[model samples]
Target: MMRKQTPWLALALLTLAPAALAQKTKVDAPPKKLYCWNENGQRVCSDALPPEAVNYAREEISAKSGLRTGEVNRTLTAEERAQAAAEAAQRALDKAAEDTRRRTDQAMLMSYRTEDDLRRVFNERTAIVDNNVQTARYNVASLREGLISLLQTAGDRELSERPVSAEMTQNIRLRHAELVRQRQLQASFESQRGELDIEIEDILQRYRTMKGSLPADSAPAATTP
Candidate 1:
């Protein structure tokens, strides 16, 4: 019975020996990393990071291999943080503007079959603005003539030692005001016409660019009148 127990004990010892040795080896192994950073312009290294080095740039090095494994960037200053935020905001705005522009270009390409169609629409718009301007100009001229006649009549009354009537005075003031208003309207219409011209030219240039990018079969040919 003693001899049989001895063999069983030896078998158990052999099985447990490797696991014990593995545990001992793991516990005795060197640390994997050392945290290092600059302190007062001097290099400082430690197995554990210090509180003072938390916001500073740091490097991780293998304790056994003595090779740098990784790095941590320093915390940004307030000004740098603000600048980064501004740059991010500007990028977002630029992306939004680019998206809007792309949508507009796509809409323009889908709406107009040819450059002639685009021009025809713009031409009609400008024609309406031109008619408004012409009408305003005619009204202004007519009002100015009426005002001039009233002023001349007042002058004649003063020269003849007769007082100007209140009714005539009121008519002169009303006509002058109407003339100024009509002149302003004429100027506004002219400005609209100019803006339309610029807008149409820009759209035509963009249209040509869009057309040029398409396959030859897909592009519209210029129509001759």
Candidate 2:
């Protein structure tokens, strides 16, 4: 399990280390049971002698851990260099993704403004569309009514020459023109709508690409060996 706080763990270890060091047991060799006196016939035994050096497990802890050490030390290896290169590449990828996102946002904002203006134009043109449709409908209704009256009067009489009245011929020509003009305006609106749709799709595609390049937010990989 992970510690809630490593600072406290370090402090506790430091506090115990001094006391453990003070508790070191001294080991020494006692003199011989019978020793000869210096240049005399008398014999005497000497007391114990002190140890050569102090002994404690905690004494060399700092040296082993590379703290307060001498010239001997470990150098950075090839594997460490590779790991540093990997980290630098990762940072570059992140920066590129961030820049892409910024550019896409600017493009989307411009597209949105353009769409708003186009939408207004579409609304205005669609109004003219409604008017054209109604006018076409009125003309068609009147033309059908006149044809029915003529058919009732002269059944099965083909009039390909079609020169009955000047006003009637002009009415037929004008109604045909109105219908053709309506189709043209409808086509115009559809063309503008298609271009607007493409711009919207392009903006969305860039957004998805930028989002896909982001790194996952899971656990980080261990870098220390």
Candidate 3:
């Protein structure tokens, strides 16, 4: 009653196993590329894409991009918006300081007799004027950024459309005050520079006059130490 196994039968079973598996398998088509050939033998671009591929390099790249774009569409939190505005204002302030320094240097160079003159004898009104201009630019950027954001949020909330706030009102007052101060400072510096230029011109004229009046036979006098 014991059954015997045959090697030829086992080999035949193995040969038929692959065919049975193939019958159970699903249909698979060749991968499609994203590009299409134009009538002129060139590829035309489109937003749509083709079917899946083995490499999927392009699809992986697109997946990352989609994630980034989704992030972009997501709303900025209140804290984030405020922080961004503050950082922008800080950067503007730093640049204003740099601008003021450069303007002060240029103004002093134009009117000053020596490097020491900037600190010693020369006027400092131009530096005040430059400070005003830089301050104005800074305020403009800061205020505009804040206003735009506020207006955008207000529109989103469907609140009153007018762009106004206590902070903005205070900024406006400061801006006017700075403008007036800048004008007065500029006037003072300009008048001082004018006076200095006249003095230099008179000195040069007198020197020429004295040289023309000198006698040809006179010997030059040497200075004693």
For residues 6-62, could you state the per-residue lDDT of candidate 1 as single tens digits? Answer: 587889999999999999999998677999999899999999987878999999999
Candidate with top lDDT is 1
Report how far off residue 116 is in candidate 3 (Å).
20
Model 2 RMSD to the real structure?
33.3
The per-model lDDT (C-alpha) reads 0.89, 0.51, 0.52
By lDDT, the better pick of 2 and 3 is 3
Error of 2 at 68 (Å): 76
Q: Write model 2 residue lDDT over 29-49, tens digit each, in one string.
A: 322231112223433222221
Lowest lDDT sum, 10 consecutive residues, model 2, at 52-61
| Backbone clashes, candidate 3 | 0
**What's the residue-level lDDT of 101 in candidate 2?**
73
Model 2: colliding residue pairs? none
Model 1 residue 177 distance off true place after TM-score fit, in angstroms: 1.2
Show model 1 residue runs off by greater than 4 Å. 1-98, 220-225
Candidate 3 per-residue lDDT over residues 1-225, each given as its tens digit = 988866998899999999877765633433332322232454443344444222122221133243222111223568978999999999999999889966854443345443343334323544654565566556556655665665566565556656666776666566556656655655665565566667545644544444455575542343222
Per-residue lDDT value at 76 in model 1:
96
Per-model TM values vs. the true structure = 0.54, 0.29, 0.28
